[model samples]
Target: MTQQHRTALKELQKLDSRIHEARQRIAEFDPRFEEVEEPALVLEGELNTTRNRLKEMKLEERRLESSTVDRRDRLRRLEERLGSVRNLREEAAVSAELDMVRRSLQNDEQEALGLIDQLGKAEQRLGELEEAHAEALRVLEPRREALIAERADARSELERLEGERSVFAQGMNPDELRIYNAIRGGGRRAAVAELTEDGACGNCFGIVPLQHQNEVRHGQSLIRCEACGVILAAPEPGSAADAAPAEASTAVTEVAVASDDDDGGDEEE
Candidate 1:
């Protein structure tokens, strides 16, 4: 009965591993979704920036027109005063002021005309960008919908597996299930592993004491690998399936460590 329960836990662990991978597959879609949306995002940003600039330019144009109006009123007042100047001195002073006001009004009118031209060009550019943005969204809709559908399918599979795990865990030995869940919590992936054929921990390659190895092989009680704390189940008879876990992890870790050392050396140089 204990052995049977241990086998159930191992099988549940395998199912959990599959669930983890399915989740990872679903997560991988996020980057692809972002990739597909990037062009539209860029265009939308440009559209917003251009629209804001257009608003500011229009405000500036209105301000210039208001200034032009005030200057026009001042020029009219000065010209009327010129005809009524009391002496040559007064007339000369009025004439000088009139020339200054006239030049200012002319400059304002020229600036307003230049801005009106710019406003026309800006409006045209905005129209072109709007059309392009609309076209991009139209072209992107199909691909984006396809990605959404694909991710939905992956999520559906994950839900099915989770339901299966929930159902499968019922009626198990409570103590054993509790232990399994505790070890599996917090994104820890390797909660249960089989003993390698040579009495070593499959997870970390540490040699299991002969006594514990015997207990694990016989499925006496749940024996955890002291080196890595993964629950040890017996490997399938006459199989090398557990042989590579430690080796593969070790190789990858070694390569990563070597790369780090090389980077450190370059930094030192």
Candidate 2:
């Protein structure tokens, strides 16, 4: 293949890797979005439980108040009976009954007072919890909205990159495409590797032999660094001296291929 063709193939490879990375990022956010949902649901449930408890306490307080009124009425009737007693025995009996009714009233009143105290405290606590719940919803609502928008944007970007990658890959040869796919499948440092001054692979930083470095510079043959296994491209001429060897190698490969084809035809005839 021509040097230009090789360069185009490398560009396409890089684009394809970017597309894959974008898709992976979108996938990662999907679970994160769901993770946020669970906490919101849990908080809602807790708020509902607090509301129900508050309602129950209020109902209990009302029932106690109603009972107190009935007790008070009974106590008044017992006191009137004490005043109407005719003899010592009758007076003692009425006095005992009145004493019993008074005790009952006192007990009911104390219980009602206690219930009121409890209800007041519970209502205060409920109010605080409601406020907290409101704040939580307010905070989480915006975060959820932001995350939703982020996910949508990521998906859109991923789709666009994928379409671009498809276009990039259209004219690439199968072997070159395979090498690109293999590198991308490995990690983020796929397809593209920088040339080092010491003729080492940039991705792995391993020392590349002089022979391989020369081959990469020529840009005619598809060259991969043995140590890092990244596709090596020659740097533009006059840009840096480190890239000269690889560029020369690319030229050598092109000339060799041309000569071999010519010799083979002669032998076949």
Candidate 3:
């Protein structure tokens, strides 16, 4: 009964650990989902940046046009005043100012033209980014849906295993369940371990006393390794099976010697 209960507890511990892992796997989807959306996010960002740049270029073009218009108006006023200038000094000064304004207007117009070219490129790039985003969605849609479905399945399995663990725990002794749950919840990989070949705890590699080994081997008593609190079970059946051949060979030798002794006695008779 003790060994049976311990076996049940060990199974419970495994189920709990599996449940933990499944939950972790489910949690991993958050980042993975974000990763799937990353291409669209990048495209949207690029499109927004291009649009903003285009706006700035257009604004600059408009400003340059306005400046050119203002300069032209000033030049016209100065030219009108040139006809009224009586002295050569006034005429020369007015002519120099007109040249400066004309040059500024030309420069402004050239800059505006350059801004229009930039705006055209930006608009084209924005269109390309939009198309790329749409294409990415088309390509990744299936993968994203698959990921979502996988996460859902994993979550469902986790829930089912959690239910199974609860049901399994009901069959274990309260004290043993408490101990197992404590060790398992405390981050230990296993709450129960099989005794190893050298009579060490399978989990902690701590030496187990012979007396405890004997108790576990009988399969009638529960034993815990003293060094580590994990419950111990007897070594599995393979070790005992390995000794069977040696015992068979010894029996065959004994029969041969007995037969030789009988033949010698018969000869003496």
Candidate 4:
């Protein structure tokens, strides 16, 4: 590949970097959106509980009404039986049953009243909870919409960048683009790096042979740092003399990173 191809690859890598960061930004809004709606969620839960309790209480009220009617009918029957008793003993027995039935009926009436009162209160509470939930949602709408719009904007930008990247890649040499993609597949940032000031691999800082440095800076074919396997490119003009002298070594290190697993280096300044 030519120097121009490496420069284009670096530009493409920069675009990909932005895309990665945009995805992360979009993901971050999930928690924030949940937080914004939490108040409404809590209120909604209470409203449902209150409504269910009211339903159960109304059923209980109906049951009590039916039991009251049955108890009244038994009381009438016992009163008639008392009048037609065979003797005083039978009359006393009927009277005792009448008293018990009256007590039970009274208890049921009292319980029914209490249940009605509780149902009224629960219904009121439910209304209040519903109102609060609506209000919570209303209060949160602006912020929620803002977050949504912001994330949408980020996504749009990401789409635009991706489209641009696709078009840019279409015009690039397929082999070089494939190599760049393979180098970046492992999530390393730098797909291609410049040769450092003193003939060292910029990515790993490995001392490159003078011959390799010359070819990377001046020739057209791809040259990787064998130690880390990062594609090397030509350094920027006037950078060599200005860069601080770095420590160098001639010991050759084994290539720990394969082509597909190799990471890219930091962006060039």
Which candidate's TM-score is highest?
A: 1
Q: Cα RMSDs of all predictions?
A: 12.6, 8.0, 12.9, 7.5
Q: Can you write out model 3's per-residue Cα lDDT over 61-104, one digit (the tens) per residue? A: 87887888899899999999999999999999999999998888
lDDT of 2 by residue, 191-247 (tens): 767556556776788887778777776545677888667887655334344444444
Question: What lDDT tens digits, residue by residue, belong to model 4 across residues 69-171?
Answer: 9999999999999889999989889999999999999899889889988988998898888889889999999999999999899899889988988988886
Candidate ranking (TM-score, best to worst): 1, 4, 3, 2
Among residues 3 or more apart in sequence or in different chains, the pairs in candidate 2 whose N, CA or C atoms overlap within 3 Å are: 214-249, 217-246, 217-247, 218-246, 218-247, 218-249, 218-250, 218-251, 219-250
TM-score of each model, paired residue for residue: 0.86, 0.56, 0.76, 0.78
TM-score of model 3 vs. true structure: 0.76
**lDDT of the candidates, in the order given:** 0.78, 0.68, 0.75, 0.77
- TM for candidate 1 is 0.86
* TM-score of structure candidate 4: 0.78
Clashes of 4: 2
Highest-lDDT candidate: 1
Indicate the residue-level lDDT of 78 in model 1: 93
What lDDT, from 0 to 1, does candidate 2 have? 0.68
Clashes of 2: 9
Error of 3 at 180 (Å): 2.0
Candidate 3: lDDT over CA atoms? 0.75
Better of 2 and 3 by TM-score: 3
